[model samples]
Target: MTKKDDHKDPALVSIGSMFETGKIRKMYTLAELYPTRIAKSLGINYGRYMVKLNHPDKFTMGEIVRLADLLDIEPDMITKVIYAELN
Candidate 1:
């Protein structure tokens, strides 16, 4: 999504909640899950990752895919992360 739509997306808000809770995994910090090389390549450097973590709509699906791979988490989990908190 574009910067204009970043905070307007509800799904992004939910994902942000997941990130904050560390419910995505033990390593919620993107830096901890992947090194500088991968994070940078994925366009999710430390600073950007923090921004996306706080505002998930700022993340592209490609970036999420990259992070999932880095964390060894199923890509589907990224979309459904909020369910874990709901249930």
Candidate 2:
């Protein structure tokens, strides 16, 4: 059985509206996704990107800002991840 709602275009729907309707987006971690794409965005090779991901302390402040922007996450989150090892 088809309804009027079935005819609606998903692309026309806003992300906020989807959230308001109880449809939440799944959040993924860096490790959960392939590193190649992120590496390409950062202009680094996969191997070196993986090294930075593992040892975040090696990242400079500029890199951290760039990473946060690239990942669409807050810089504090990256900061926490980098400093989490100390505590």
Candidate 3:
């Protein structure tokens, strides 16, 4: 499937919901999950910047993709909420 198709898949949609709902604890418990690197690369600290950005409120698809990339997740994993707005 194309990348855009993956973004519209139900599974990835659910994953993005986890992010939107602040269920990060569960998601981050996975050993492979790591968003800190992306945050650092972007010169941000997830905790501080999230608070600064008022996360769960101001998140954009582009921002989500950047975070997902840092966490080694596919952009689709974090785009469910912003996809409509993005398109």
lDDT ranking from best candidate downward: 2, 1, 3
Better of 2 and 3 by lDDT: 2
Question: How big is the RMSD of model 1?
Answer: 12.0
Tens digit per residue, CA lDDT, model 2, 1-87: 112244433332332233234342221235335467666766788888777766667777877666555544455655765675435
* Residue-level lDDT tens digits of model 1 in 9-84: 3533444456545556423343344346555756646677665655555667787676555444455666555344
| Lowest lDDT block of 10, candidate 3 | 25-34
Stretches > 4 Å off in candidate 3: 1-38, 45-48, 52-54, 81-87
Query: Which candidate comes out best when scored by TM-score?
Result: 2
Overall lDDT per candidate, in order of appearance = 0.51, 0.53, 0.47
- Candidate 3 lDDT by residue in tens digits, 1-87: 123443353544444456655564332232233445445654667675445233433555566666564444566644543344334
Pairs with backbone N, CA or C atoms under 3 Å apart (clashes), candidate 2: none
Each model's RMSD to truth, in Å? 12.0, 11.0, 8.6
Q: Of 1 and 2, which scores higher on TM-score?
A: 2
Regions of candidate 2 where Cα sits further than 4 Å from its true position: 1-29
